[model samples]
Target: MSEKDQEVKDQELEEEVAELKDLEEQESVTDELTELTTKIDELDDQLLRARAEIANITNRNRNERELLQRYRSQDLAKKLLPAIDNLERAMATEVTDDQGMNLKKGVEMTLASLQQALKEEGIEEIPAAGETFDPNFHQGVQTVEASDDVPANTIVQVLQKGYKLHDRVLRPSMVVVAQ
Candidate 1:
């Protein structure tokens, strides 16, 4: 071949190599863009999850606050239960004289007022006598033999009355159970 033809062939080979290099660079840039887009999508998904978790936490805290507020008087009402029982016992006593009768009447009025107040605040007596013995609401202080009339795990008598505030037990009933 002549020198001029050889030079032309060399120039063609160089142009082809340059074109291939440009194509490779473009492919690399496209691959980089795809990877960056995938990373951005993952981050956006994480941000959405974070926001959802924050919302859940906020809702849970609000519910807890409302429950706390609703049961606010539970502690004080529980402490007053023993005093109420004593007053009830006092009411059961027989009085003869005018002074004794007057005092008894006063005691009855006080007891009635206390019960009304407790009822308004959602404090209530736990059903014990004639009910089946439930360990959740009744504490068995003594157990009696089961008779034909009374089944096993039945509450025969409530030794000390139990009380509750809403669905929560302020105090479990002390009771005698047939077992």
Candidate 2:
């Protein structure tokens, strides 16, 4: 072939590739469109795969951002524990019916407000009463002999409460169980 014919063929091939790329994007190239479109569909399949890969990467990045946002407060809250411990100790010792009804009322109100604040942040006490025993949620410190009504391996008493954050265990409840 003449050099001019070769140049024309190259231009035609380039145009064909560009057309295929466009068809692939619209997903309109198929066996029914034409034989050339069938080959375009093969290229389209690869294009589809590449697009899907990019979409997956975008979704993964979004998920990571959401997870970071969710756990952002964990570090700050860890630092505040000692003050909370002191407050609880003081509250426990200060409780009395002799401090006058107003003092008792004030303390109860303070405790309720504190609990409400924690609840808003997704901190909740693990259920301990009248539920089936679970080693995962409960730390069994002791086992007591059981009667027929309670059943063997059932929870009898809760020594301390546990907590969860978004389906993850922050702590396990300490309990006594029937065995």
RMSD in order of candidates: 2.5, 12.8
lDDT of 2 by residue, 1-179 (tens): 99999999999999999999988866754545687877898999999999999999999999999888776655544444444445565566654576656665766677677667667766667798677788889999999988989888888898777766556566778899998
Candidate 1 C-alpha lDDT tens digits along 1-179 = 89999999999999999999999999999999999999999999999999999999999999999999889999899889989999989998999999999999999999999999999999899999989999889999999999999999899999999999999999999999999
Stretches of model 1 off by over 4 angstroms after superposition: 148-151
Worst 10 residues of 1 by lDDT: 70-79
What is the lDDT, from 0 to 100, of the residue 138 in candidate 1?
92
Best by lDDT: 1
| Model 2 residue 12 distance off true place after TM-score fit, in angstroms | 34
Instruction: Look at candidate 2 and give me any clashing residue pairs.
Output: none
Compared with the true structure, model 1 gives a TM-score of 0.82
